[model samples]
Target: MSTHVLFIHGLWIHASAWRPWQDLFEERGYSTSAPGWPGDLETVAATRANPEGLNDVGISQICHHYADIIEGWDEKPLVVGHSFGGLIAQELIANDLVAAAVAIDPAPVKGVKVLPFSQLKSGLPVLGNPANKSRTVALTPKQFKYAFGNAITDEESDALHAAWTIPGPGRPLFEDATANFVRNSPAAVDTHTAVRGPLLLTSGTEDHTVPRSVTLAVAKLYADNTASVTEYHEYEGKGHSLTLDAGWTDVAEDVLAWLAAQGFAPAGAQGAAAAG
Candidate 1:
């Protein structure tokens, strides 16, 4: 059976943010899809222009939306996600919906114990205002730099912000921040599942939004699930923008390698299948 890949983007970015990733995976003979969140606009400009439309979106709604998409797929897909999308990927895996899953700097799911000051600072743009819980929030370039581009140059950070940044729902951020304290939080994941397929969690060393500590905490949750495979990788000096930054291909190649090792893709194949 052909390996189908589902690419999910995180907040403060539109679905177009995964275009490069989709292209790279397709070159490796994988069919890929990047489905937008509910109320997501086609472009950053349109999204920024109508930010309020995303106001009421929460983690549960977004998770169910992607779940529906995954359910409709012709083949069980290899799910890959970044930040908030990463958490969604874990949720899907927990529900036994995906063949395998990769989460890159995933947002802290319920029970993640390490909450760095930097992470709180990065989230302050939305969490600072309780009113924002039901509103859309757009990150300023400065906030984006602190959260995602801290490891890159100023010029590159500015360029990336201009190209990929967009408004995202504040409710999900609030939901994640308070998930540990809330009963039956939407951000909770079933890490103890025996039926979940191979899972990989990648962390960027310099990431402030979802720091190494947070990813490590998340990795620990799956430690007892010996029935399935769980792996963790850390990229030094990389930030949350690792997937979209100048060296994004490095991370993509690493993920491709991992997928091959886990038997999700054909062994030893570097690019597309040969022409008939």
Candidate 2:
């Protein structure tokens, strides 16, 4: 049997963000986990009311959280992540804790160059606030609208805001410490090169937070790691909200197909196999 699948989430979001992916994998009979970032509230309502809870969520804490989940798995699971979670996935890979990984629009890791104006603009609030480094920071409605919901319509965007927007730890957003300081730490990458596991990176053509250039730059980092092989995909008109918007299911299906190709599933999974 293939290894289980584990998903790590990014800032301002919780494991619930992976619900669509979880549903798909569950249908395919694969065990899955969507462990929370430290202090992650289970629901959107709660998160809105308690943004400060996110303050305690730091890179080290979140990394250890995923590490615990990985330890409990029977085998080294295939790890996938988006945004800040992508950075976390790299950390686990460096530690030799995963069989495969997919980093979807990962945040800026140590040494990745070519920051996009949109990315810096999206992060301006946190970067502008000195206290953000050690606290939880919630986005103002305007800030949230631009950074995350610009591609979608106002109504749908408003709903998304109501449903998933929350304050998150700001440390990782501005984390400039050693790479090994947390997951994807610079030290870890240097000492633990050559993951030899399959790595996939998907970027949205219209993504602003992680522009096409930066995404490619990040891919080069993993390629630099001496990973046995790496795959890349770009979805047209897809934004930072690639996994939550209209075409999410197709994207999930594509990921499912890729996993099956990597032998993450049975041969029959190539067709209309049940969701794992």
Candidate 3:
């Protein structure tokens, strides 16, 4: 009775980014997968080398791609996503495809307001540029440091910059922030409503990209509606790079702990996996 878990990465990152997470979850006996974004595995490296190819993919296409992955799972798994991936997790739950979910520093969905200055600045790359209406946007070193790597060390941030920083889809972000998001296509951003499953939201205190308020704001919508348990956690001194940063294991441990508390782990949960 092993419950499978699916991990979805956010914008500009490839599924391979979840490799470390996969190892951690697998050790706990929960099966896992991080499906590639449409054309991501195929073109991310090349796109980063040139950055021009990112224009080929858009929000609609990426959402469809993730939806296909969710549909193919043997069973609805505990969905965990970061940034844009978090939006997809909620989209799946709304459609009744997920058993539970954990959204880490998730990007705000359609209808979710932007109240924090940090969030506005984090979104400037996409929302601020009119050209982003139909194009991809790459973050400069300064932008990345300000928006995503503020909490990590200089050395780690440098490595992150070298290996993972790349152009992200402009259309999906623009659509989430601008285009009517209540539709059923892509991520179900427009008109998307409160979910019906257990949800655990984790926010980094230093996460300028998705502040504590934004994370809790999403949880509030689900608090009174869903019978599902809803919880929010804030990890102090952590930044937007919570998953890949030095303290990622602590975050992972927190997720494991929360899932155990919810009775959401698979029946065979052992060692780090067992709530008992």
Candidate 4:
């Protein structure tokens, strides 16, 4: 049996953006897949052409969708997620679903109370209008630049926007934004539980969408769970685009190294696979 790695994408980014990571993990002998959020189409263009399927979708629905898929799998996967996907990754591990998880620049869960201005601004596109809670929202190039591409050149940011940006359901944003107030909010994760898979939470200091402060706060929330391994890493000059931008491999390589440290060798008796 081989270890499996599941990649989960965040808001405004199509699932296909994980293709590179999937290919790399496969080369290391791990079976992998990047399943889109519920209602995502087969391709970026197709999803953009018709995003109605995701309208009104919320965090719980998205979680259930992935949970169903994981339940069908033969082995618990090592999940790696970015942005909102990072939150989902934590939820999965906290719920005893996946073997372990890597949450990169993940949105703050319920217990995290720090709301940075950059994070607020990044979410305003959806949270600014109450009506957006029940609709799907798309970020403009300018908004994408501020929220995701600030650490890179404008030209590169624009190119990335054109390639991977897509409509994202506003409900997850709304759910997370109001998590601190909502009791039993779907965005809440069982961070206090001391018996779950090892978790690695990463942050890009330049990320506006989910600021480094928020991710660090999340790590603090897990500090009480001494029985489980929870680690944090910071990328000084990266932004939310670190997962898909020009330097994505660096972030992916770090994750590969962390997994090795956690004793998750590449499947099929392969030794720790070198990051290409």
Best by lDDT: 4
Lowest summed lDDT window (length 10), candidate 2: 183-192
lDDT string for model 3 (187-241, tens) is: 4432224546777778898898888887777766666664556678889999888
lDDT of 4 by residue, 1-276 (tens): 226899999999999999999998777667789999999999999999999999999999999999999999878899999999999999999998999999999989998889889999999999999999998999999999999999999999999999999999999999999998999899999898758888999999899999999998999999998889999999989999999899999998889878877878665333434332
Residue-level lDDT of model 1, residues 1-276, one tens digit each, is 438889889999888989999998888878899988998887889988988778789999998999898877777789999999999999988888899999999998898988899999999999998998898888888999999999999889989999999888999999998899999999999887667788999999999999999999999988988888999999999999999999899899899989988877754363433332
lDDT against true structure, model 3: 0.74
- Each prediction's Cα lDDT score? 0.90, 0.74, 0.74, 0.91
True lDDT of residue 208, candidate 1: 94
RMSD of 4: 1.6
Model 1, stretches more than 4 Å misplaced?
266-276
> In angstroms, what RMSD does candidate 3 have relative to the true structure?
3.0
Cα-based lDDT at residue 50, candidate 4:
99
Query: Which should have the higher lDDT, number 1 or number 4?
Result: 4
TM-score of each: 0.96, 0.88, 0.87, 0.96
Residue 260, model 3, lDDT: 73
Give the lDDT of residue 117 in candidate 2: 86
lDDT of 2 by residue, 53-110 (tens): 6784677777788888778767788888988888777777767788888878777566
